[model samples]
Target: MVTIAKANAELWVFPLSGPTGGSGITAVDVIVVDIEDSDGRAGTGFSYVLGGGGATVAAAARDMLERFVAGQETVPPQALWRRLAGSLNRLGRGYGYLAIAAIDVATWDLHAKRLDMPLYSALGGVARTLPVYGSGGFGPTQDPDAAVARSLEYAGMGCTAVKLRVAGAPADLDRIRAVADALPDGVDIMADANEKCDLARAQWLVNALADVNALWLEEPLPAHDTNGFATLAANSPVPIATGEHHQGVVELVPLMQARAVSVVQPDLAMMGGITESLRVAHVAEHYNLVVSPHFLPALFIHVAGAAPSIRWMEDFPLLEPLFDNPVGMDADGNISPPDTPGHGIQWAHGARQEYRIAE
Candidate 1:
């Protein structure tokens, strides 16, 4: 049996073009993991922090690798994930999950490469194209006219849907209306509050979004407010979408069970990599809920191939520039997983060298 020979983790930091809406995130910290087996095969995986904490995550990854992964006999990625997570049961789930995420991703990539198949096919999925929504161009403070122009730009690109950030204010309704009025007949609109509202304002915003014929209202309240979500979902006309902030399937199942959320948005790092995120998608399917992952369409398009519940992929291009050949949107505004072995993500020629943080 092949055994893990060595595992290494590195930290890289890249500044965003500007501070993002609501979160005010000005930079992204990437923790990259590379693992090689006794037989000489290698794979790559990564996790990210929105604003800070790269060194902590990288350190955690190193600890986990040295303690659990190195020299261990090869196992299925799912089983390996369970082992690592179970060992950390008492360690609290903050940055540890992000650390596990990078290793889990790398393990999955290695498994796919060993089998001489693309990740989707290795995960028991056929290669298929999935729909994408334009998820940029409008921040919480953006003007309605600019929002309309951005929506039109997405429309020109053949995207059927676009998402804009909302701040749960009275003017949010007018802003949504302006964009809706500008878009063509079939194109849909979605709004993300980014956890900027309390229950009262979230309730108001949901009704307002429904009145404007929006596709959905995302993260209106904080992710932990399950009781509020259940209460609001019971009365809201439009669907509520959340899940990016949640850490694992354990946290998501409660929301799904209560019928609190209609759409589940899993982030790769937040869900601790493809293994748990896939579990979330399958669990969402059982609840008859829709799955639209948070970002990194290049990585998630593979998951979409494996999970029928994933109907939409977000096209917020944050980390795409760091990769040499990320999958691109089709002329029809849909994206598909690459047939190449593994996830097919490679750092650009000098990206690692340029962004690597000195230890």
Candidate 2:
């Protein structure tokens, strides 16, 4: 059996061209991990923050590797994950899961590479092509024209659907209307409030989107407000979408049980890793809810293969620009898993030199 020989992690910060709407993401925080087995075979994985706290997450990642993962013999991926999760039992959620996600992903990459299989196939080869939705526009600074222009950009790339942000401003509905009107025939629209709205305003936003026939209203209420979501789900004209900030099944089970949302979005970093995210997808399936994981389409493409519940891949390449060879979109506006042996992400030749955070 291949035993883990060494593990190390680093933090990389890349500035975003602009903010990510209400979240105000001015930069991306990337926590990168590298693991090697006795034979010198290696794998890499990473996690990120949108705006801040990257350094803290990076430190947490280093701590996890040095303390819990360094000497552990390579075991089944799930077994190692449980060890890590159990270690974090006392620390609560949030940071612990985010930190472990990078390491867990790195371990999975090693596992897949050692087995000589593509990561997606190793997970469960459902379909090679995962349908994608254009996921930008509606940032804090975007005006109605900019929002429409962004939607058109995604449509130009052959995406069938696009997501926009709704900042709860009085002008949001009008902005949504203008953007929706600008879309070509057959294109669909989705809106995200980025947790910027309360129940009353969320309800209003949902009501206003009726004229646009939006596919879903995402994160209109804070993720913790299960009751608020239930209320909205019960009466709002649009289907509710949330869970990107969720840690794992603990948070998701309640949301599902409460019938909080029709589409459950699991963020890879926040959910721990692919293993936990798959658990979330299975749980979502049990509740007859659809899985539309937030961002990281490259990684989630494999997830789409394993979990039949996932219907759309979000094409928000926030960290992808740092990769030498990121996933690409097919002419059909779908993404296919790389036949490469692991998760198939590599830093661009100068990425580390360019974006690595100085100590």
Best by TM-score: 1
Identify the candidate with maximal lDDT: 1
Looking at model 1, report the run of 10 residues with the lowest lDDT sum.
15-24
Per-residue lDDT for 51-117 in model 1, tens only?
Answer: 7988999999999999899999989999999988887889978899999999999999999999999
Whole-structure CA lDDT of model 1: 0.91
Tens-place lDDT per residue, model 2, 79-149, is 88898899877888778888889998898899889888888777866555877999865574468898888
Please give the CA lDDT of all the candidate structures: 0.91, 0.86
In the order shown, the candidates' Cα RMSDs to the true structure are 1.0, 1.3
Count of backbone clashes, every candidate in sequence: 0, 1
Q: In model 2, state the lDDT of residue 245.
A: 87
lDDT at position 46, candidate 1? 95
Question: TM-score of model 2 relative to the true fold?
Answer: 0.97
What's each prediction's TM-score?
A: 0.98, 0.97
